[model samples]
Target: MPQTSKIFYQLKPLLQYVPSIEPPEKRVPLQDKLFWTLGCLLVFLVASQTGLYGIRIGDKTPDPWYWFRAVLASNRGTLMELGISPVVTSSLVMQLLIGSRLLHVDYSNKEDSALYTSAQKLCAIVITVGEALAYVVSGKMF
Candidate 1:
């Protein structure tokens, strides 16, 4: 096990309490899967168009992150402004760590795999909060 894996192992007790969906006991039908996929897509589209409650974008305000927004599939002043950035960032970071041997994970071991996933979730949550704070503090969301 790598050094970072040891650190993650220490967090196992807390990570176990993180909410997760259990695997389905039976195979899901194709129609049901399609329905859920479309439902989630609809929700995402709606969220992308939903403006933040207290934010108002002025027409003349310059967007410093305009190019970044396009790349991240984010909409300005909307609920989906962050898009999938946090999740993607966390995944990339985890991959980098593992590739560098900073973290060790055994894919064949259920416990190690679960811990790895839980760590990624925790990382994503932290990144999301940090990014939100940065945006607010930089006066970009005002």
Candidate 2:
């Protein structure tokens, strides 16, 4: 077995508690896949339009994230304000760590791969919560 990063070893105990979707027991048909995809898209669209309650938008305040929001498909003062940022950011961080040799991961090994994935998910969750807290603390939603 190749040498793994200490960080990965330390996180191993917590990985089991991370929520994950199980793979389908059988192969899904194309039509079913399409239906599910569209269903999720519809849900996301609806959620994007659902504004966060009690968020006061100041008219005179210039939107600093106008262009940033456009690129991320996020709606200001909405549930999707965080957008796909947490997932993207976590993936980038993990990739950079592995690429820089800061975190050694053997992708060919099943255990190693699984651990790396769980680590990414954990990172994403932490980032999402951190971002949400920052928004509230900084009064960015106002």
Candidate 3:
């Protein structure tokens, strides 16, 4: 196992578990799936509009890349300021690393596969905090 993979396994224990939907007992109707998808989208949009608690007192600067926040699902000073940046960025890097063969992990192995997934989540979380701090430190956000 490479250093990165080992770190993921080690960190997994300390990370909070996000509850997700388990496998369904049977296939859902297409209409049901569509409604669920739409509902989730609505929720996401609403959340994005919501402001962050206790983060209302910040000097708003012109974001050079304000467009990315929407694409990344991040809202300024909101609960989702971290948005999906961490997950998307981490996944992208991991895919590239895996594709370039820089980090060797046998996808065929279950443990290795789990390690990769866990690593992605860990990397995202770390990135969320790092980016948040960077923004505040640089006076881009409060």
The runs of at least 3 residues in candidate 3 whose Cα sits more than 4 Å from the true structure, single-residue gaps closed, are 1-25, 54-61
Q: What TM value does model 3 have?
A: 0.69
Give all TM-scores, in the order shown.
0.89, 0.89, 0.69
The window of 10 residues in a row where model 1 has the poorest summed lDDT is 53-62
Using TM-score as the yardstick, the better of models 2 and 3 is 2
Better of 1 and 3 by TM-score: 1
Q: Total clashes, candidate 1?
A: 0
Instruction: Give the Cα error of residue 122 in candidate 2, in Å.
Output: 0.5
Largest lDDT belongs to which candidate?
A: 1
lDDT of model 3, residue 141? 69
Residue lDDT tens for model 3, 5-109: 565567566544632245699999999999999999998878777786656725466666579877987877776777888888889988998788767677888
lDDT of each: 0.87, 0.86, 0.74
**Candidate 1 vs 3: which has more lDDT:** 1
Candidate 2 Cα deviation (angstroms), residue 31:
1.1
**Clash list (residue pairs), candidate 2:** none
lDDT at 66, model 1: 88
